[model samples]
Target: MRPNKRDELVSKALNVFYRSGFHATGMDTLVKETGISKTSIYKHFRTKDDLIIAVLRLRDENFRSWLFSRMAALSDAPAGQLLAMFTALGEWFGKPEFAGCMFIKASAEFQNRAHPVYQQSTEHKQMLLEHFTGLAKAAGASDPAGLARQLLTLKEGAIVLAAMSVTPDPAGDARYTARMLLQPYLAGG
Candidate 1:
């Protein structure tokens, strides 16, 4: 099926923003990549900043849904679900075209605390934390909040390593480390 115009724009914009920093991406690039006119693009997205916010929102929703679906497919046991989360992240990191975390990238570009994109990135992180916390609780974790925080730290650390030029397999290493750290919790579960 043909993709809708909004999806097309989003897909193109994601690539542009992912390859080039968000600050470097321009409407013209999105227009050329999507084969949509400037008017149509603006009609859907009032401004470049508006489009960026939309893209970030779309990215957050897409990532959350993808992670949740993977977790759901695993056994109802919390241990299994937690392990699956690590595996899923490893798989994403292993993708040939995998770039560093989009939220992290955007946040780095827009360091201002008041920046809308930066705030969206913070919200995205919080959402992930909540998701993990819920999973930890379901798994009968003794300290669900703590476990979630640790997992978030591990994930963010891995993203940083992956972004670095020296760390090959940063994602895989991070997954391994996370699994080791969470092994006790899973065993308790």
Candidate 2:
């Protein structure tokens, strides 16, 4: 089935926001990039924040789907699947269109905790944390929550370093660190 005008708009806006930041890309830019008039955009979204939330929801769905599927494909066991996250990150970082973490950018642009955009960004991270926690439990980690938070931190750091070009192989470095972190949980450390 074809996407409706609102979905199409959100998709287009997501691209624009990914390329340009949330605050930098104004309504005019959105209209120009999305090729949808302000009147029509407002018809679907009461405000730009509402549109951003919609875009974030789409991103959350797409990103989590891709990451989890890649993890599962890369490793059958839960322990390996946790490490596979870095492999998946390497693939994503290598993409020509890679522009760092959208949720990170969103949170930076929308710093106020009360802001819906910021809350949405927080929600994205929370979901990832929950997934990591579940995987840690499945992997038989002694401290599932601790391991999950550590992995999430490593993942986020790798993303930041990659985006900033701070390291030539942040993903490789992160994967190595992740291996060490997962050592005790593995069958034979």
Candidate 3:
């Protein structure tokens, strides 16, 4: 198979995984969706677990790059950048196909703490926290680490509410809450 074929398969698999979920999706389903032979699929990914890891890694890299680019375009003021992050998240959650956070969805599929996917999900959250921490420090927060942690909690809570509730504006509501939380920090800055 061509190199592009491998990429195409992964991309298709990601969409399937995101929509139907990992445990619900099978290799046969992926093969049928991608119009690729099972043999071709195996040639690229030896096992279902391997494919899942690759898809998750791709997701993490894409999210990190997209976030960094968005953050880079904001004001040097960390508070502003932090607010922008929440705004971006709101917009994302409001999308028509937004079923909830990919990592969060995947984490729910596994109850086992030792699962590799669980570790990957945890790493994704940690990366977001680290990014927020850096932004908080740059914005001149008195306690960047604390502010970052708080923002993460706010974001996670919003995601959970959006996923579980019938409200259409979970992301917007969450951003509003985050702004309220950050007001004191911004005033100090």
Q: Pick the lDDT winner.
A: 2
Rank order (by TM-score, best first): 2, 3, 1
Off by over 4 Å in 3: 1-3, 187-189
Q: Write one digit per residue (lDDT tens) for candidate 3, span 1-49.
A: 4568887888888889998999899888988898888998899888988
Estimated TM-score for each candidate: 0.88, 0.96, 0.90
Candidate 2 clash pair list: none
lDDT of 1: 0.81
Best by TM-score: 2
Residue-level lDDT tens digits of model 1 in 1-189: 766888788777877888777878777776777688999888888889888888899889988899778877865677577667766776777777778789999898989999999999999999999988998898778899998898788888877776664577766776687777667766553
After superposition, which runs of candidate 1 have C-alpha atoms over 4 Å from their true positions? 1-3, 187-189
Overall local distance difference test of candidate 2: 0.93
Give the better candidate number (1 or 2) by TM-score: 2
Report lDDT (CA) for all predictions: 0.81, 0.93, 0.81
What does candidate 3 score in Cα RMSD to the true structure? 2.2
